[model samples]
Target: MAGSYGAETTQGERYRLSFTVGGLLAPQGRALAEMYLNRMGDGSTERSSQAKVSEKISEKANEKSDKNAGEEVGESIAAIRQQAIEENVLAIRTDSANRRVVAETTRRLSALTVEELAYLAGPDSSTSDREALMWIAMCRYYAIVGEFAGEVLKKHYLTGNTHLDFEDYDRFIADKATWHSELETVSEGTAKKLRSNLFKAMREAHLFDKKSGTVLSFLPSPSLADILRKRADSFGYLPMRESSL
Candidate 1:
């Protein structure tokens, strides 16, 4: 999150492994997508569109009885928008008010294709679809997350394993850190936060049991799979049986 959103594996490229962003936050994602679409439909520029979304979030915050709490929420969302702009995720650079949360959120949202984003924010998407699609978005956005999905989750399923433990995550991270200098630099506390957030996201996506840590059985719907299949390397992020794919 401290560096640019993402980079290729090339030597000259800027790559930094960041996991400071929290879980899926599906509700917030949907809200932001809806607001973005609406603003675009109304002929607002990308900059203005994000500004409007921030304002709307602020207005909603203002409705709360506690003025201080309301103001804080407004400020946070507004700061996030400014951060997005500064990162060039949203057009037009601004002051550096945004932090890792802003960088991660904007990068995640941008990772999805317009069709994927529309489906995610639309009325027809089921809860499961939204969760799965969000997972796909995260994979597409962050190489670290995508590699974990492809390496650990997919391998675990293929090997007929149905459970995941912190050790699996620790081992994977440790192994990857050997090659990825970006990851090698992470402190233990940051790595723990990364693991916690990842597990939470998997649970929310219904890919893991909330209480038991058992790998849940899930496959994307045919329509959803079809959408993902159209994109190179995207469908493989999901842990699916070989025959199912």
Candidate 2:
């Protein structure tokens, strides 16, 4: 499924299940937000600012790259730079474990507003706020994850059943696979990693308890909540009642 972008299913729904990249990359997101702010603050046009930022980020990566590093590291940096150019975000160090940091970061950030990006990078943003916003960003970027959160998690929360385990993920994937051939094409190993990464992200976002896997209390900050509410259907992705907001 390396090049599998996705296709519309029989049900007229398109799903992109290529979420095997990074998981809740808050640090990278913060770094990118700061870089964006720096570039955008220079009174330059958006296009020029993005271009300069991309060039500088690539130069910085090349400068810091180890001279004696292996070919893989060099290639990773090149890919990272290319993704940075394509995504308009600064490229950071390559993760040996996950080489899609820049791509994933830009995708998540694309879901947010400049104000939201600033909040993520600002001094007032707490860990909880960042995590919640990151989860929202992920939900906005990936429709399948958003569907799981909205259809499965929200429904479970409303029904007073908070338990969320691998069984729940398996069932959700199985059900979606019927309407989403892309999901069906994912290898068992890749599917397992996807499930693991989703749970890891949810755990970090404080959506559930790490020990018991039970849904936890979650309420975004007033500002963040306001941002989401302004976006059509954004708040619906979270397992929260509208009246609660």
Task: Tell me the spans in candidate 2 whose CA falls farther than 4 Å from its real position.
Answer: 1-14, 43-99
Q: How much lDDT does candidate 2 score?
A: 0.65
Using all chains and alpha carbons, the TM-scores for the candidates as numbered come to 0.71, 0.73
Best by TM-score: 2
Estimate the Cα RMSD of every predicted model relative to the unseen true structure: 11.0, 10.6
Write the residue-wise lDDT of candidate 1 on 82-117 in tens digits.
533544442323344334445566566656654555
Clashing pairs in 1: none
Residue 7 in candidate 1, Cα distance off native in Å: 7.8
For candidate 2, write residues 133-199 as lDDT tens digits: 7887787667778878888877778889998899998999889877777788788888888888888
Q: Evaluate model 1: give its TM-score.
A: 0.71
Off by over 4 Å in 1: 1-15, 44-103
Q: In terms of TM-score, how similar is model 2 to the real structure?
A: 0.73
lDDT of each: 0.62, 0.65
